[model samples]
Target: MMLSTDNHAPLRRTPLYGLHVSLGGKMVPFAGYDMPVQYPAGVLKEHLHTRASAGLFDVSHMGQIALRPKSGRVEDAARALERLVPQDILAIAPGRQRYAQFTNADGGILDDLMVANFGDHLFLVVNAARKDADEAHLRAHLSGDCVIDSLADRALIALQGPKAESALAKLCAAAPSMTFMDAGPHEVAGLPCFVSRSGYTGEDGFEISVPAGDAERLAKTLLENPDVMPIGLGARDSLRLEAGLCLYGHDIDTTTTPVEAALEWSVQKSRRTGGMRPGGFPGAEKILAHFDHGASRRRVGLRAEGRAPVREGALLFADATVGEPIGKVTSGGFGPSLNAPVAMGYVPTSQSALGTKLFAEVRSQRLPLQVAAMPFVKNTYKR
Candidate 1:
């Protein structure tokens, strides 16, 4: 949700900027691009619509890269990629995607990313903010035989919610065949597209990557569906938060390890010490130790007692009077789907259980909080 443009630089615009403006989208500078924060229907309605029906999001700012081996072997490229991250990349089948994180030497996360086995090459979708650093890391460590191709000519868009699959299948007949985390190339609306049955809103959806020149046409074609509406950054953040998804710089960073962020599931069993392929990526020792001995602090879900929504950086305490601070809220907000305030943050391992009682200091008042299970709402993925 960190979308502020640099003060000195000029703001950029996506290919669908004109369409957004024509739809009465309120443009705001975010991550160097002038993006829509909300449409005429506002953030709350957009958020609800995504859960009830479908929503279209212009995510062209995300970075897309492809790793191809000069020798034309998929295993060669997958093995080369395993050197940078602690994920079982070599085991991923063609047309399947895996969630992974780039770790540092000190067992901290550089960024969380999605890696897809696109048959002949590995496709990656990295964060818009950390794309430069991630690309630099890949180029610096990967073998010379592997080539890195940045797809600057592409534009990415996500169509999310319950009706997403049916709406999209009308245009691309093969889209509905893909299950969760499956990705493949198809012609959508008569345009070449790489469609992934995945999204951050905990819904059944697809993230479609199309040519930059054809982005507007693809978006307009999708919007013609009554189930689909344009959603903006404000709703994007709220939806992901309600789904308990981490917002890169805020929830997980270079200082936070995958174990501490409660993302150990992303580190596949094969990547661990006793599996088929083990201990090859950065910080494997320290990261693996957390699996043997639990981390000192762990991320957990928090549900506030009342309706007063707590925001990020709110101090957390064990007692209402606050003898000492225990943790801080990383992402917190009102979940339109749940009709309640939900938050996620790191707390001492002792207090990270499913129903531990806690307190959050918000605006100089202590609010009672209970450590609860995440995904404040249920995930409706097609898997």
Candidate 2:
């Protein structure tokens, strides 16, 4: 659902543009880039192939930023960032990563991003669509002691699936030893790179950040292995949807709060009551209140009753098809991994329990829906 629509304006291309085209990538406008929606093997094959083997993904369109404290104190920079997000940045040790979000004054998410500690500085990777706004917000709020540097000179690529370890280990031995969420510098094929043991798919993988000039060579080097194949945006969407991961604009947006989005677990313990540091972030009062007393509505996974895959914006109704709508699907599609239609939507807390039934008003038909548990496909993360 984060896909971009075609327009008269020219679309930007990543450094891997020629390589994607060489591999017969079906390029489309996405997040301001002419990204591949799928390869010649197609979305279904790409999805299944990623689950079974390894899939190479060009994610350079994402924004990568680094924050350094001007003052000699590293903890000062961490504290300054903590003031913008509810997560505990001070607790993230060097070479480790944590998920966080920038919230508005009303506790609604501005964007979800990954924060990694690099000893002297903190590295942040934000969504492409909101990168400019996120950078401005950080500058506006963060104290003058901290400096934000956008890493426009780098490109990011993800090698994901069961074979990700062995494939990457051939290039960098340190890769396989890293557990999920671990990030650090590594040398790959004589190239200096930063490899993170993380990815969007619910699979064991590595997201590598390399110099923009060398991105194509790095990608080609990885593709030389028989286990890896080029994956595109289409399979990426279905894979994440099946894994129950929230998309930036679809599953989460400015109007949806963290509590209602079921992302309370990301909030660090130190930020909550009875902790060392409490209530310093933006929207702390309203967000923490919902933590104590749960939100009236909560995001839940839904399973449609037939072959038809319910899609985004499908209205949901309770009991019968004719009544006031209860909720609507935020992200939905045919899950290639599950071989069934899976979706995520917001519903009343009363009807959020597992096994509770609802109806999705899709194309004038009342499709039976069950409030199912998330991650329709179990996560294969390297814990």
Candidate 3:
């Protein structure tokens, strides 16, 4: 599925573009910009380096949205957002982040976003491909006094891997203690930055939000650590896939609901089945039904045999069934850490059990696969 794009390609650069090229980055077109797909280190080496040490990524293509309400009642604005997403945004405390997806009237996902209540306004980081769609959706349905301000001048950077914390801790003005999924603004390298104890790689890391102009300087300062090296988009994709994280357009879309993606736990029961604060939001009925019953197609992890990787669009067949194909691969690649191929996709609920055997059609050959629990690689999230 192609992401909607405007007449103008809308390709823009982050402050780190020059720095990336200086480090011998292999640039590619991603989310409509000149982005580094891999550095001179290559995807394999970059992936291993990040798993072992620290990798700094320039993720400025992701959308940064701020909701400034007339009343400045952040909770009220959060309620407006909660009506759109599955996460408990209204009840989220300060200095915390919630991963949520916007659903349409039919309970299908429109876009996935990270909402942060920044005291005065509701902050969001949206997928680059879905930025326009997400912004329009928010603008059309927002409550009174809410205004959507897309922070185009802001840049986002992620420092991921095991040694990420110690490297960043040196620059932070104060020792900002953080748990997984936590977020706070801090002074880094004598410059103010919004630091979140979160990342897509399933590793312990932080996403730093800074002014666009300052991104290059801050990135340079952070990469001063011997353990820190410039990572790129190629490693990012493989890392997240190995960690069992979904990519928005590939793994989820308008027809994919939270329940089908195995994200039912993201919606709290209290808000789901109409607890104290009932879920009276859009697609609540469908979401609740899926919660009470379940979805027809459920996303699961599959461990494939041999060195061959089953990529997205590969049809899944349970026990060699011809007419009834279970599902298709969403994201799949060779996992360096596991030394085997890993893939994730949706399959019928009956066959979603662990150790269930299945077949993935790769070219003319059908490769045998075993249904396994997700996070094919162990998640090192600080939580």
State the displacement of the C-alpha of residue 376, model 1, in Å, after optimal TM-score superposition: 0.9
Model 2 scores a C-alpha lDDT of 0.91
Find the candidate with the highest lDDT and give its number: 1
- Worst lDDT 10-window in candidate 3: 1-10
Root-mean-square deviation of candidate 1: 0.9
| Error at 191, model 1, angstroms | 1.1
- Whole-model lDDT per candidate: 0.92, 0.91, 0.85
Candidate 2, 32-149: lDDT as tens digits:
8999999999999999999999999999999998888998667778889998899999999998999999998888899999998888888899998888899999889874869989
TM-score of each: 0.98, 0.98, 0.95
Every model: Cα RMSD to truth: 0.9, 1.1, 2.0
In candidate 3, what are the lDDT values of residues 60-118, reduced to their tens digit?
98999998776878888887787787778877788888888898888888888888877
- Model 2: residues with Cα > 4 Å off, grouped in runs: 6-8
